[model samples]
Target: MKWYALLVVLMVGLGLQAQEEKDIVVKRTLHLMGSTFEISVVAPTEEIGYINIDEAVSEIKRIEALISSWDENSETSKINRNAGIQPVKVSRELFLLIERSKKISEITDGAFDISYASMDNIWKYDGTMDKMPTASDVKASIEKIGHQKIILDPDEQTVFLQKEGMRIGFGAIGKGYAADMAKELLISKGVKGGIVNASGDLTTWGTRETGEKWMVGITNPVEKNKIYSWLPVVESSVATSGNYEKYIVFKGEKYSHIIDPRTGYPTKGVTSVSIFSKRAELCDALATAVFIMGRDSGIHLINQLDGVEVVLVDGDNKIHKSAGIVFDTNQYVEK
Candidate 1:
């Protein structure tokens, strides 16, 4: 054989060998970030897969420790503790997360606010709520709920809550951020394929054991054990926000337990909102924001954004989707 042809053959062999290294899949699930976190990694051997999964899990736990609002020593809690008093210096990692969160709040117009922690659970869904909160109390409940109140100092790497009683919680976007971070860690370590599912806010990279794209399904908001639609998700993130089970009925109006930070009231009109994006954190936040924005407004906002799609289930069980969300009729199931 010619020397050049031999070199080409050797290069192809080496490429195939590298591809063969990650031949098997290993998936592990555990309770983390206040929800079930599943990590799947494909490696040359089962042991390497386990190792990658462990490192990913550790990264997620570290993130949980940093931003957990319930932890008194967490950076987020520290910022809340000193609300209106002083700015609390935080790690650069935490600072960037808060800064991105603030930008999302700005884009969504406060529909997705971390400062929503000030909201009171006056609207319960566990068969206890009977009357609406007084207007004044409702106003007071959201007094400190404002994303603009969160001041971030990049130079100092500090976070400050403008109001004394204001607080921030990652319950809306923490898991997805954790998932994103975990995926990055695993990918950096040479894992050929993996998935980081934080509860239902999940992100996937590469293919499964069968070498096909990841397929995700949206749960039917109107029917149990049925799905509204399924889509192929490849190297992307998807998150859904809804009060399928938790809701209250007042004067023949159904209200979900997802409280709107702007109004300090339960979300209505839209039943469920699912968002697809490249960032898990963004998808998680947008799901909640779109639910609050309702059908038309939510679809409009999603259309304005790039590389994002949404599916909204309205009160009448009608499905509304964004421009890019072209459903495969074969995968679509009706109520």
Candidate 2:
């Protein structure tokens, strides 16, 4: 799913009411990478806090310049412009990001693809679609979307798309990548604790200024305002992909905005999927993949990976968690 406008509510448990004498949490919220980002850091003084936050913002902007497809001069745009004609030499950072994206595509069997941009905008969730697209049109929309067609030359630091119109985008993973980069930059600047919340794709390191582990509340997809559970995010990342805010109903059948790249159709059954992992980038990509993978197969895949867990809410409003995730919530349901 292109989560730029997806409604994801991650209730951060920052103790704003009380604080310790020596340390305090400073935060800033702004728009970046076409999404909302909240950057927070532990600092002894407000002056130092804003300075650190500014540094993180600069780092995020730097990443935006490199990865944004909207920017015609970006490496990603350059590669897209050269599709099928020639390989475009890119920086090692972009090359590696694409390489990692392809690896994720392989893992999910194309449930998540950076090449999803090649798809024609046939389905709109903004209540403008009077009817569904024809089957042939839907099928043709995804003809150019295949990560396998993306060629990467490590030694030459280049990327090439085999089809002339083929395109790749980081909409599903860009914010998380930016968050990860911002966190790393903050840590390198001697910040003891912080959080980079790229909308709902968030990562936390160290603890709150109160010296307590960072806690995050998982919002109930059905209830919207209600939180089902709160869990400690100790040095980890969380990403939630939900269809509650953006979806369409046709012929009494609801369709999520998160489409299956393999079929070029909206996913069904699952309403939300939240992933917990060591990196926000992985959590961000896997959340969308798991939502499209559906409940059974998604849970199965998460169980096999060490240090990765899932908490998914189905269309029935029932919550399911992987083996490693233990939380007390009335929404829990077996199977």
Model 2: per-residue Cα lDDT over 1-335, one tens digit each = 34533333443444554464677778889988877788888888989999999999999999999999999999999999998999999999999999999999998989999999999999997789999899999999999999999999998888999999999999999889999999999899899998999988999998888778887776665665666677889899999898867888889999888889999999999878889999999999999999999999999999998999999988898889899998768653211
Per-candidate TM-scores read: 0.89, 0.94
Instruction: Write model 1 residue lDDT over 1-335, tens digit each, in one string.
Output: 00000000000011122344347767788998767776777677878889898999899999999999888888888898899999999999889988999999999999999888877666666687789889888888899999889988888888899889888998888888999999998888878777787766888888775576677766555564455566877899888876666777779887777888998877778767778899999998998898888899889999999999998888887888999998765654432
Residue 246, model 2: lDDT of 81
Q: Pairing residues by index, what is the TM-score of model 2?
A: 0.94
Runs of candidate 1 exceeding 4 Å displacement: 1-22, 220-224, 331-335
lDDT comparing candidate 2 with the true structure:
0.87
Model 2 weakest lDDT span, ten residues long = 1-10
**Number of clashing residue pairs, candidate 1:** 0
